[model samples]
Target: MSNFAESRADLESYISARVPLISIRSIEQDRALRLVREMAANPRRGNLPLWIYTRATGTRDLRTNAPTSDDRSWPGAMDFAATQFANRPQSTVVFVDPDDLSDDNSASRHVAELARLADANAGSIILITDNPLWSGLQRLGMSITLSLPDASEMYDVIHAFLTDHRGVVPIEWNEQDARRAAEFLVGVPEGTAINVLATIVTKGSVQRDDVEHLARFKDKHFGDLAGLERVEVAPDSQQVGGMTSLRAWLDRKHQLMKSDLRGTKLRPPRGVLLVGVPGCGKSLSAKAIAGQWRLPLYRLDLAAMLGQYVGQSEGRLREALDAADRIAPCVLWIDEIEKGLAGQNDSTGVGRRLVGQFLYWLQESRSRVFVVATSNDVRSLPPELLRKGRFDELFFVDLPDSDDRQEIIQLYYQRYVQREPTAELLDKLVGLSDGFAGSDIESALHDVGAELHLNAGAELRPEFVVEAFANTMPLSRTNPEQIDEIRTWGRERAVPAGRPPTSTMSGPQHAGRRVVVLSD
Candidate 1:
């Protein structure tokens, strides 16, 4: 059944059962009111008279679309509702912004009294508001949530807007583009989506680029709501020197990840967890995946979600995850995931609850939000996160192997030097920088560039790069125990990101390198 149809049926059943007080929580107040009006006029509902109340409009008979009396205040409205119930016992009264009653003790009592009267008289009082803030009414009524429109509803919204604008402005969209646009608009309200579509087509015509424009629109509107920062990934940033296994897996699932597989039994690819040494391109892999897939990227800051008030943290988390689902077919990059989830054993139990909520969403959410979580300290992570079904795969991104180092060196050289490195230089640097992470390689190359800049007319040479490598200390040498521990854990639990090291280069080059203690 359609979502609206199902909701209508459920609401009808509640009314038929004489549910006295029904609280509807929704941002779409207009839509909810319209549905309520329709239900009031339905023959199955006994054509009950519909009364509506708002702070601005006071109390009005919806059937007549006219103001009933001067009792616009909360207490006055309660008295008016009572009078109506006494006269017509089978009526429905809807209060808009009833959350206002939460702040007024007298109004709250009046609401409670009205609820009791409605129960005895077979009338109904519906409270409609964006937030479910009527705590006092909780035991007296049942709450129904009206979610933002889904993809299909969004598509219909687009179609209706296009039909409305027919011949007024040029419209260019195929079924595929329309579907994609709907996906891009998923987490937005129907009203906002219509306004966005209208604004896009206002210039001249709606092009395929409108899909990306919709993404930006969502980022601007919804990104800040849930402690998520929309990361703007450049198209040229897809290059990564290694992670052959992860790259291959992503390539295989790229199409399925973006496609709408609602009817099919196959679930979309969840994501990957990259646990390894820091500066080993774990975070880089996330950016590369989003760029490669041509999807939007968002960084979730779990630390920012902590709230001082009870349930606030969980509320923020729920909002963030819901936003992620709304902006689906995108990559959610959670860097240093262990830091976010490390407090699972804290005394307050907030950490445990947060972890539980995140895991539940990760497992149950069918949205196309592919999560790419990178962690430097795997030991700090809970075992529940490492379970098989949590992510598509767990990858171990150790220090680059020889071939990976060679490619990384060449890539950096070409990028920084504006020219490819000679094969001899590449081979020597690959051997000399053994156990160096990708960041270490880039640092060495950057130092070489700095040297060349200092000597304005000097020719760039391979020996200059070798000198820089020798002078720098890689993390492996400085934190051998930690690296060894991480590698040991990865060996048994995760797939290697690159092929096994095959170089036999003996490394006295790293000898006498300063041991800089680093913290993860």
Candidate 2:
């Protein structure tokens, strides 16, 4: 059954049993109301009238916004609801996101009184809110959380929408396209999905490409990222030099991310923890994943989340994670994760709490927020956070080897100089940049490119590039011990991000004697 249909059935039973209070938790208020209205119209309930209350429209019929009560205030609505529940039986009143119910406040007390009347008269009071009610109030009744639609439900929603506007605007999307668009809009609400589809139609035509454009439309809804910063992933930014294993793993995850796994027991790959040498492509890998997948990139600044007041840091972190949940199918980059997760023994205990909270979210959240947490100081991180199930994989991004260096050299060479490097120069540069990191190569090439750009009359020569590389000193040279320590831990524990070191033959291989087929 569809999520909404299942929810409707559950709600129908609650009302049929005369449950005093029903709390429907969801951000999709309109969708929840529709479910309630469907339950009210159920044959078993005898199509009971709905006493829907909103702040703007005090008490009204669910079907129409026509006010059933003249006073459009909270106290007035409460009194009206109480009177109906006390006098009339089998009455259902729905309050749409009423405030001050979070505590034992006046509004909550009023709701409690209404609940008592509801129970005595065989009526029910429905609370539609995004947040959970106070334990005292919530304990009086049942509550069900309606999460965002999954792939199958999203497909039906999209199909229905497209059917509604079949000829209104030019729609080139086929069934397959609609299904693919539904996968992208999995975490989005039905109304938002339709609005996005309408937006595409507003452009005069809905091409097949509109399916991929759904992510961008979904991104527009979440502009205010409280604790996260949007990192722009340029097309060229995906030019990661090394980490072949990590990239291949991410590619597989990307396929799963785009696939329709609606009713499956399987879930999309969680994320990877990249720990290795500094100045390598660890941080850049995060951007590469975002760029490659064409998903929005958000950087979680742990430092910025720190606050002077107690619990403030944790609150901010929660808000950020909640925001991430809302904006799913996106990459969340946490650079230098060790720094944020460190200081577990601090007096304030905030760091420990933050670590626990982050790990909990990482494990429990079903949102498709692919985390790419990079840590140069992996040893400083808590051992619990490094558990096998915490991350999909812990990759050790060691310094690039000969082949990786060559690829890195060529990548930045073409990017900066706007031309491919010569074979002889590439060989020489690769041999020269034995211990250089990917960033080191890029920086060297950038200088060479700058010189070529500024000195327009100067020709692009291997000498200029070689000179720039020769003058560069990498992190491996400056901080050899730190690099060695990271590498040592990586070799023992994590998977290598780069291709395994290949062994070369001491001499040329002996040629095998040719064999002719005996039977023709």
The candidate that wins on TM-score is: 2
Per-residue lDDT for 423-470 in model 1, tens only? 787788988989899999989888787777788888986777888888
lDDT of 2 by residue, 1-520 (tens): 7778788878977887888999999999989988887776666656675789988778897766688868988878888888888788778889898985887777787788789888998889999999778877888899878878876788888889889888888889888888878767876788888888888878888898777677787677777788999888888898898778877888788888776666787776789999988889898999988888878899999988899998999999999999888777789999998878886567889889999999999988877888999998887898899999999999999889998898899899889899998899999999889999888998999999899989998888788788888999998899888788889999999999998766678768887899988986
Q: What do the candidate models score in CA lDDT, each in turn?
A: 0.82, 0.86
For candidate 1, the 10 contiguous residues with the lowest summed lDDT are 502-511
Measured with C-alpha atoms, the lDDT of residue 13 in candidate 1 is 77
Q: List the residue pairs that clash in candidate 1.
A: none
Q: In each prediction, how many residue pairs overlap at the backbone (N, C-alpha, C within less than 3 A)?
A: 0, 0
